[model samples]
Target chain A: MIEARGLTKRYGGKVAVDNLSFTVRPGVVTGFLGPNGAGKSTTMRMILGLDRPTRGTVLVDGRRYRDLASPARHVGALLESRAIHTGRSAQDHLLALAHTHGIPRRRVDEVIDLVGLRDVARKRAGGFSLGMGQRLGIASAMLGDPGTLVLDEPVNGLDPEGVRWIRDLLRGLAAEGRTILLSSHLMSEMAMTATNLIVVGRGRLIQETSVEEFVRGASGNRVHVRSPQAGELAELAAREGATVTYSAALAGASSAAAASTFEGAPGSEADAIEVAGLPSERIGELARAYGIALYELTPRLASLEEAFMDITRDAVEFNTAAPATSEGTR
Target chain B: MNETHDRQSRDRAPAASALPTPAAAASSRQPGTATLERGASARSRRGSAAARAGDAPSGAIAGDVTQARVMRSEWTKLRSLRSTQWTMGLAVLLLIGLALPLCVSASENWTVADVQAGSQDPVYQSLAGLLLAQVAVGVLGVLTMTGEYATGMIRATLGLVPRRLPVLWAKAAVLAGVTFVAMLVASLVSFLIGQAILGSHDVGVSLSSDGAARAILGAAFYLTAIALLGLTLGALIRHTAGAVTALLGAVLGLPLIFSMFGERLESAQRYLPALLGNAISSTSPARLTDLVSPGRAFVMLCLYIAVLGAASAYVLTRRDV
Candidate 1:
């Protein structure tokens, strides 16, 4: 398990990681989700004791990382895929780390084959492609067969197959009762692999929840009804306690006159409407009762990416268009 | 039907069922139940077996990151790099190559009365390569630390041993040991070859002669000290070009810069690395009255390393990787 309490880091006047606390438990892949510059890497660095925390403590297996008799045996971290000497071969690099804790040479070879890097193990790491470099890094992290794994952007340079490979690897490690904390900006990836998620935005804790709870908690579970009688159905759904909004494309799809021709029409073009707090079945039944020819009635569960955006909307550090209050200096 | 079943299982299993078995976990296939369980069980088996075999300190792969292990790691690191071989090879070559030709020419000139007019101190004449080889040794030392920072390997390194100081100590110990052994052999070989070439000339000095052994050994000592100084500098200035520039400038530049102060500061220049290098490599005492004793020069080199070493250790622990 990895526990960070009140961890804070500041670079000059800029805060990289603010007061934050979280526990990464074993038997699950805990996804550390954040947008770019969200301080995910900084927090991981503090956990590994690579960066001194300005004001708090982080412990791996209930002791500070430095205090562990053999840190690699308890905590294996891949902070950066290319955090290796390019001049050395993959085998030598793993061996060097293994020698630090007296980990046997066979373990190094084992990890090399485990990561499917046996073929290129003897070549200089400088020549490896990004995918190969990431493989070598994963190999190093697994060299000690540690009880915990912390990987940052593990799939950044991986192919589709490699991405699937890492998801499986992390899950397998977690199943062996190891705490797995993997960080990524890709929410969909995290949704697939992470059992629990600790999400941050602009260096502050936004939420910590299971992937299922996170998706379920997003506000807009809505049904989209596309029909020539959308105007009448939107009114009928609104009267039944569903929130209705005109789909912008509706006006362009059919005709402007067909929409604005009716005063107080819910839909602009009278072709489509979005109804929230109502199931597609109910919307379809309502259209049937009104004898409205419905072409499409589909429930749209918010994508994980959309849910992430909604959760981090206030906390996003980089927004293309400035919202309000002029907080860009951050 | 198969795709539907796969998607149904994936959607129904929740987080716990996502774990694959060992056979499917061999990094060959897409995520499957067999792969997750196989990978998990295989690791557990290996983990417990290895732990029971005493390869690790605990039932898990646990052992203290001791100083000895770190030193061995540094040895592996020092040897694995191609630059290590190139720089060390150049140092050895420069030491012996320059000594052979220069000593032979010096011996040939001793026969001519006009040639005898040249400075004929055999020890200093024979070890001319010591001057150039110090550069090579210093570069090796500088690169040893800076290379990690350059490639970002330092993050991985310190992540494994977060106590931090052990790394510096190990690196210094390994580099110093290697430099001492390699440079000492070079110095001794050069001296023997120089003496062989000199062959009974007035300037010829045997290993038994006064200060002859001290001079040869001190050359190695001086080179090792320079290497430590380079390491200390490399730690302080983590960039390769910058650290090497700073090392070369400090070692080679300070003497000339100090000498510009002229006679009043002449005595002070003896304490500088280059001057100390010269004194340690000489067979005779300092010709200048103000120059320090050879024994004192050796101590001065150690003092430089000590001060830099302390500063390096301090910066290393306090700074972010």
Candidate 2:
């Protein structure tokens, strides 16, 4: 288990990680989700004691990482793939690290085979591809048979097959009652592999929740309806305790005159409404009672990617302005 | 905590069931399961040993990171690099190779003025190659520390041993120990060969002669001291080109720069590393009045190393990796 409390790291004038706190428990993979410059790497460094926090404490299994005896045996970390010396061979690199804690040479060979790097184990690491470098990093992390694995961007350079392999590897390690903390900028990847997420934006915690709850909470049971009398149906749904909004394309044209013209209009393709806090079945029934010709009634569960973007939009470090045409309608 | 655990278990069930195919494929295609099993067995053995110890609250294992282990790790790292072999080999070569020419020419052109002026003191003349060989040894020492920073390997190294001082101490110990041994052998071989050549001209001194053994051994000691200075500078500067420049400027350039000031800085010149090294390695009676005693020069070199070592240790622990 890993615990970070009031973890703050400031580089000169800029604060990288600000008062961040979280707990990573055993038996599950916790996805550290953030934007590109949201201090995920810095926070991980602080946890591993690579960088000293400005004012905070990060403990692994109730002790500071430096204070832990044989820290590699308890917490194995792969901070960056390029941490190995380029001139050293993969086998020798792992052996050098293993020698620190007196891990046997046999263990080094085992990890080399485990990571599927046996073919290039004796070649200089400088010549390995990015995927191979990541494999070597993982191999070194596993050399101590650690119980806690902290991996930063583990899938950055892997092929599709290698990505699948990492997912399975993390799952298997977590299944063995180990704590696995993996960081990524993509929510779709975490949606597949991680059970819990600690989302950060602009060096601050935005939310910490289970993936199911985050998806469910962000989706909010929204329903989508397309109809000839969409404007009237929107008014009815809004009056019935559902928050109704016109779709971006149709919102500009949803005046009273257009609503009246759309009523009984057979081929009005641009009339649609998004109804939150109501199910599609309820919206369909309401449309039938109002005699509105319902064209499409579909329950829309927001994609995890969209949910992540919506929550972190303001906190995005390099946000671009919305298009001028859509700005007035939204 | 209990609620979190319950939620975790509930969450893990679906995740575990969702990836049956990939997990099975991974195991079938790779040596995944057996490796994990072996890891589990090793962990169990370590866990049992920790339990038996009963004294370590942090589950300290038997072979946890120690000074000795770090030293051993440093030895592996030092020997595994091809640069280490090249730099050390070059140092030995220059130590003995350059000595041959200097000793041959000095013996062949021996004259009455050279003997009167004490320029033909066989011990100092034979060990003249130390000037160039010290450069190679110093470069090796600087690379020992700066190589990690240049390649981004310091992260892996510091992560392995979070209590970082042991790494610095181990590097120092290993470099000092190895350089001392190698340079000593080179010095001995150079001294013996140079003396044999000088003996043909009836100007050679035996090992038992006054100050002869001291001069030979002192050359190795002076070179060892230069290696430590290189390491200390490397730690302080951390960049390869910058640290090497700083090391060379201090060791070789200081003496030349001081010479341009004439007799105004004559007293200060003797404290420079190059001058101190020359004093320790020279047995010429004619230059005795201008140079410090060998013992005093040795003490001054130690003082320099001690101060630099303390600064390095202080900076190493406080700075972030």
Candidate 3:
């Protein structure tokens, strides 16, 4: 378990991680979510005691990281893939780290094999691709088989198969009752792997919630209904305390093209109404009672990505005024 | 790309199967306890004998970050790098190789005017290679610490040993120990070979002669101190080119620049590293009134190391990785 209280880090005058407080419990993967420059990496560094906090403190397993008896035995961290010396071979790098805690040479070999780096373990890390470097970093983290794993952007450069492998590996480690703190900007990935999330924006805590609640709360329950009588159904749903909006094509046809093209396009297109603040069941019941023939009724649950975008929209640091393109006009 | 993917997938097949067995075994063993801790304790209970025999189960041995372990780790780190080997090899070569020509020339040019002016110290002449060798050893020391910073390896290192100070101390200890042993051997060999060449002209100093042994040992000590200074500067500056430049400026530049002052800064010149090194490695006692004694020069060099070491320790612990 890790607990950080009022953790603040300021580099010169610019605050990197502002007064942030959170708890990461054992037996589950806690995703640390933030945008670029939102201080996720800095927070992880502070937790591992690599960077000193400007104020407050962070404790790993109820003790400061530096105070832990065997720090690697308690917490294993992969701060970055390029943390290894480029001139040194992967095996020698792990061996040197293992030697620090008297971890045996066999354990180093085991981690090397576990990470599927046995083939290139003796090669210089300078020659490694980003994925291989990431694997080596994970191998070093697993050398001690610690109870807690702190991985930042573990799946950054991974292929689909490698991404799945990491997800499974993190889940398996969590199943063994280990606390896993994973940081990433990929919300869909977090939705699949993380059960709880601690999201930050501009170095401050925006939300600490479960994956299910965060998604459900950010986007209210919405139902979509397609019918010949979308106009009448929209009014009935609004009277029942539901906010309703017609689909763009239907709204356009009803406003300007209703009299001119209504008879021409009759039965050719189905008018759809999007109902919010009401469940699909309630909308179906209301539609049936009103005698409005509903051609289709479907519940639209917002994806985690949409929810993340909605909540962090104001928190994004680099807001582009227009879509960026590579072309430059003279 | 497709072929590499196929190869990587084939490589990952066995790894995927191999990973879950340990997790399952760990969960079955105690559920929440760290698997490695249990394995380490079991291995410890099984005794170091089995561990030493290399037949203990594939598990981590119970250990914490200690000074000795960090020193061993630093030793492994130093020895495993190609740069360490190259730099140290260059140092030893310069220590011995450059002395040969200087000794040959000195023996050939030995004149009564040199003896009359009392400026010719055969011991110091044979050890002339130290002037170049010290730079090699000093660069090695700077690279030892700065390399970690240059490669972003300092984060991994500090993460492993969060106490921080042990790493600096260990690097210093390892560099000092390796340099002392290597340079001592090189110094001894160079002195012997140079003395052999000098003996051709009947101007050689024996090991039994006054200050001869001190000069030989002092050369090694001075180089070792130079290595430590380089390491300290590396820690303070944390950039290879910058730290190396600073080290060169202190060891070589200060003495030259001070000599140009000529009598006005003569007292200050005696304390320069190069002058101190010359004083420590010279055979004769008090050749000049302003020159420090070999013993005092040794102590002064150590004082420089101590002050820089303290500064490095402070910055190391207090700074972000």
Candidate 4:
């Protein structure tokens, strides 16, 4: 269990991590979501006791990380970047860390194999690819086999296979009752992997809730009503609390302008009218009462990407939208 | 955070740490209860126990990193890097490689008058290589401490051992050991090689020659002192180029500047770094002298090392890593 209360870090005149508090509980995979430079890395550094907090404190397993009898045994954190010496072979790096606590050499090989770097375990880490570096970092974190695991952007620069491997490994660890807290700005990835979400924007906690709840909450009230009675159905949907905006394709929507078809399935488009503070069930009830046998009754939800973008729209310190080019590797 | 989850985690780690079989050991003791009392870092009320509470989690049986472990880690870090070896090799090559030939070439043109009057000490004359080689040793010393900061490897070091003092001490101890051994071998070999070439003028190698052994041994000590100075500068500057440059300025630049000004001002020459370290062989008519004894020079050299060393440790321990 990792609990941080009012952890703050300031570098000279600029604040890196402002008063932030949250607990990563056991038996679940909690995703730490934020845009780039939103203080995710700084928070992780303080969590590992690498950087000192300007105020308050962080507790890992009910004690400061440095105070732990064996910090590696209780918590295993993989920071956003790799920390192993490049000159050393991957195996040697893991072996040396294991040796510090007198952990057996067998565990080192286990982690190396677990991360699928068995082919290159004996090779120098300097020669490894960026994906391989992340793998080795993950391997090192697992070397101790602790109850709590912290991985920051573990999927960055990974191959699809490597990304899947990490997702599976983290899920397995969480299944085994480990407290798994992984950070990433990849909403699509976290949408599939995380059981719970902790969203931070501008170094402050924005929201902490279950994944399903977050999706549901971000979905809000936007829904679609497809009926032969387009005008009457639109009126019924509107009375049930949804705007009747016109679209150029699919089901026709009525407004001050002439009839135009709506595009796609009503649920996925970003421009779809948001029906806030209403349930999907209410839309269904209104559609049935209007004798409009719903051809499509879908609630438009902000996608994980959209919800994340919405939350970080103002908080992003660096780039906001994904760069025009493809995301490198994973 | 990962360190917390690591096998040596702060909470359950001590019991698991240093134990070959954590499972068997933890079975004998009641879990969480003992860890709660001694494992957690709690704020206790009042004096003694509070003081003990400040150190409550410190005395655990496991994760006990001894001084030996620290020294060993430092040695491994120092030796494992290619830069350390490269620096040592440069020192040997500069001192032994260039200086031996230079001394031999100088001897070819030597006159009896030149030998007797140009310089009082011929052996010390041949040992000028030390002046150049000390820079390489200084680089090696800087690399020992400052390289960690450059590579972000210092974070790993501090992670393994949070208290900054032990980390600094370990680096010093390892550098001292390596520098001592390297200097011992380098100085002896350099002396032997120079003696071989200086035989043309009958100006070299009289082991029976008074001050010869001390000169050779003192040269080694001089190099070692230089290495310590390097380590001290590294701790202070925390940058390889910066530390090496500062040390080179003090040992080399200051010497030239002092010698130049001393050509005019009276006693400034005696205070030059080259003069101070070279004072061991500075005796003119006598094999050793009372006015500027080797012992007193050794003492001064030692004082230079001590002041830098104490200041290094003081700054390192008092500040965060």
Candidate 5:
């Protein structure tokens, strides 16, 4: 189990990681989703005890990382793939880390094979491609047979096959009841692999929810409606607690124009129409009240990226929080 | 799937410690909180547990990353580096292979009367290679620590071993060991070759000889000390060009530069590393006991290394990676 309670880190006047808190429980892959420079790497570094938290603390298995005996055995972290020395071979690097905790060299070989780095384990890390470097990093992380794995952007430089392999590997590890916290900029990857997500923006926790709940919550469930009176309908919809957009109006107008031009059949892009935020039934009632015929009414569920953007557009501002304020009150 | 089975122990933050305080803390928080009630309840739950564990003294560092392990790791890292091998090889070849031979032939070609007129002291005269060999040793020493920073390997090194002092200490330990060994071998080789070339003059100095042993031994110690000073400077600078410039300037530059400033400059110049190093290798059975002895020079060398090493440790431990 990995838990961070009010963890914060600061660099000069910049708050690299704000007052953030969350738990990554075992038996599930908790995806750490954030925009670029959103403190994902900083948070991971703090968890591994590489960067000290200015305030609060992160614990792996009921103890701070440095406090744990054989820290690698308790928590395996790959904060950056470039952490390995380029002069050493893949196997040598893993062997050296494994030796630190009395872990057998056999485990090093096993991980190399596991990561499909066996083909190049003996070759200098200097010669390996970025994908190979990531594989070597993953191999080293697994060398200690750690209980909690923290991987930051593990799929950053992998091939399509390598990406799929890692997805399956994460699932397998979580299935075995290990705590897995992986960070990624890719929302689609997180959607496929994560059971739980702790979304962060500008170093503060935005939301921590199950994938299903987060997607649904951010989606907001507003249906799209169109009319020539889109501004009026949007204002009406906004007052009614529904979010509306201009794209739906364009869709409705395109449909209206298509019907007029081609034998009473509506195309998807009729012009001179407004898109309303109300449900289809409600839009019909309102359209009838306004005496404006509805050209198009479509139920739209926002994509994960859209929801992500909507939430984080407000969140990036938190990245500019005072360094002193970032130090967790906890 | 089996979340409940992974029940972890109570651990919150380093700030929390003990049961009574935890109980008090839990109660201290408003039982019925306002808007943040959910997060508040979770905090109380975990904070109380953390207090209990922390109140009891935390266990010793897991595996206890002792100075020994750090030293071993540093030794392995330093020795395994290709730079370490290349530099050590350079020190030996330049000091023993090239400089010793050049000086040996130069002294051999000189007439007996001319040699006697030209020489100030045999102890200083026999160890001419010491001057030339220092460059190689200094270069080797500087690279021992700064090379990691240059290659961006310092990040990986610090990540594996987070405690900064240990990493610095380990590098110093390895530097001392490697420099000592290489300096020792180079000194012995230079000594024998110098003696071989001086065969006709019959000013033979053997390792078994009394005053001969001290000069030979002192020369070895002096070179090693000079190298360590370079290592310390490299660590302090943490940049390859900066370290090399500083080290060379300290050893060779100061003396030559000071000589140009006349006797007044040369008088204070004795305090420089090479002067103190020369004081160490200076030999005379009766006179050695007085003036600047090998013992004093060795201590002075240690003092230099200690001050620089301490500076490296302090800066390293405090700076964020």
Candidate 6:
């Protein structure tokens, strides 16, 4: 387990990580999420004691990282993929680290095979591709089989299969009671892999919540309903404790799935009202109670991507407008 | 915040499958607990049991990062690099190769007038290649630390042993040991071969001759000290080109710049590493008149190593990687 209390890092006048305090407990994958300039990487470094905190302390298993007898066996971190001598072979690089703490030579070969780098174990690290370099880094982190694993962008340069492989590896390790903290900007990947999320924006904590709550809390539950008596249905839904907003041609203007779902319906061109804080089934039941003809009632559950965007909207460091293009440009 | 607490509590529930396997956990013993050579660093700690708390986690027995293990790791690192072999080979070659031509030319030009007039010190001729060979050994020393920073391997290295200073210490120890052994052999071979050629003219100093053995051993110490200085500069600079340049300037440039001012800076010239090196290998009293004795020069070199070595360690612990 890793606990950081009031961890702060500042370079010159610019703060990288500001008063960040969090606990990474074993048995779950904690996703560290942030925008490009956020302090996820800096926080990880501080936890590993690579970069000293400007103020505050980080502990691995209730002690400073430097105080640990064998830091690698308590906390194994993959800070950068290419953090190996390019001129040395993969086996030699791992062996060099393994030699520290007197870890046996067999364990070196074991981690090499564990990361699926056996084929290229003897090849120079400089020649390894990005995926191979990442594998080597993972092997290095797992060399000591520490209780805590901190990885920064483990899937940055991975293929689909490699990404899936890493996801499974992280889950399996977490299932085995390891504290796995990984950072990534990919919302979909985190949604699939992370159990809990520690979201940050511009070096400050935005929210720390489970993946399920993060999505459910950010975007309110909204339901879209179409009816032949659109005006009356809207009034009834509004009166029944649901905020309703009417839309025309929303079927074509919104998602394509929403448009296709109501195609060729009896009230396909009828007016529709978007109801918030109400389930689709309740809307359907209300229409039935009022004896109103309902064409469609679709509940729009917000995706994790939308939730991330909503929470980080104000925290984004670089905001850009859409570039203007001349009409004649192909 | 309440939800976060709730989620954290839920996460705390024991994960049966996630727990470390009994076998793998059992292998996590304190690093040197299995070995008898517990290393000087282990005993230096306040209490081994208290430090071992972080290493032992009930079923898990993590290894301890003893200084001995770090030294072994440093040896592995230094030996595994292809550049180590190339540069060390170049140093050995320069030491012996340049010594042969210098001895042969000195012997051909040797006359009673040159020897009686004390124009050329035979030991100096035999070890003249040290000036050129130092560059090779010094660059290797610089690369030992800068290569890690250049490749970003220092993060992984420091992460493994976060005390950070031990890494620097182990590096210095390894470089000193390697350079001493290798350069000693090189110095011996160069001296013997150069003496064999000079022996034909009866101008060669035997191993038993006054100051001859000291000069040869002193040259070895001088080169080893140069390598140590390289390691220190590498740590201080943390950049390959900058550290190498700084090391070169201290060893060669400072002495040349000091000598160019002639008598004005004569008092300070003897303290420079290169001038001290010159004093270490020169056996003639005439040459010693302008500089301190070899013993004083050895002490001066030690002072340089201690001061720079401590400064490097200080910056290592205080600075961010």
Among these predictions, the greatest lDDT belongs to 3
TM-score of chain B of 3: 0.81
Per-residue lDDT over A1-330 for candidate 5, one digit per residue giving the tens place of the 0 to 100 score: 888999988886777788899999776788998887789999998887777899999887778876654566566677654777677677777766655555556566667767777788878888999899888887767655666899999999988878876776766555445678999888888877777889998788999997767766664455655545555555555676666554523443464443343334333433233233456677667667767556666766666777687778755554355534434432
Candidate 6: C-alpha lDDT? 0.79
Candidate 1 vs candidate 3, TM-score winner: 3
Q: Which DockQ values do the candidates obtain, in the order shown?
A: 0.33, 0.34, 0.31, 0.13, 0.10, 0.29
Q: Which stretches of model 3 miss by more than 4 angstroms?
A: A226-229, A236-271, A277-297, A317-330, B1-62, B112-118, B286-288
Q: Rate residue A247 of model 4 by lDDT.
A: 42
Lowest summed lDDT across 10 adjacent residues in model 4 chain A is found at A321-330
* Cα lDDT tens digits for candidate 4, B183-301: 76776677677767776676555555667778777887888888889989998999888998999989878767766775574365555455667877443444334235788778988
TM-score of chain A of each: 0.81, 0.82, 0.84, 0.84, 0.79, 0.82
Return the TM-score for candidate 6, rounded to 2 decimals. 0.84
Residue by residue across B64-148, what tens digits does model 3's lDDT show? 8999999999999999999999888998999899889999998898864563355677788778789999999999999999999
**Best of the candidates, DockQ:** 2
Interface RMSD of 2: 7.4
- What TM-score fits each model? 0.84, 0.84, 0.85, 0.77, 0.77, 0.84
lDDT of residue B250 for candidate 3: 94
Q: What is the C-alpha RMSD of each candidate to the true structure, in Å?
A: 7.2, 7.1, 8.7, 9.1, 10.1, 9.4
lDDT of 6 by residue, A191-292 (tens): 887878899876778888888788877756678787767667777778888887655457445645434433433353566778887778888888899898
lDDT (tens digit, per residue) of candidate 3 on A1-330: 889999999887667788999999766788998777788999999998989999999988778998976788778888854789999999999999999999888778878877778899999999998888888998888876776799999988888767766777776666545678999877778987887899887788999998777887665557888887777777778898988876556445554555333324335456777898887888889878978788899887778788788788776723233212201110
Task: List the lowest-lDDT window of 10 residues for candidate 4 chain B.
Answer: B38-47
What does the lDDT read for residue A102 in candidate 3?
A: 94
| Runs of candidate 2 exceeding 4 Å displacement | A219-221, A224-233, A239-262, A265-299, A317-330, B1-62, B112-119
Give lDDT per model, in order: 0.79, 0.80, 0.80, 0.67, 0.67, 0.79
Model 4, residue A267: distance off in Å is 22
lDDT (C-alpha) at residue B232 in model 5: 80
Query: Model 3: how far is B175 from its true place, Å?
Result: 0.5
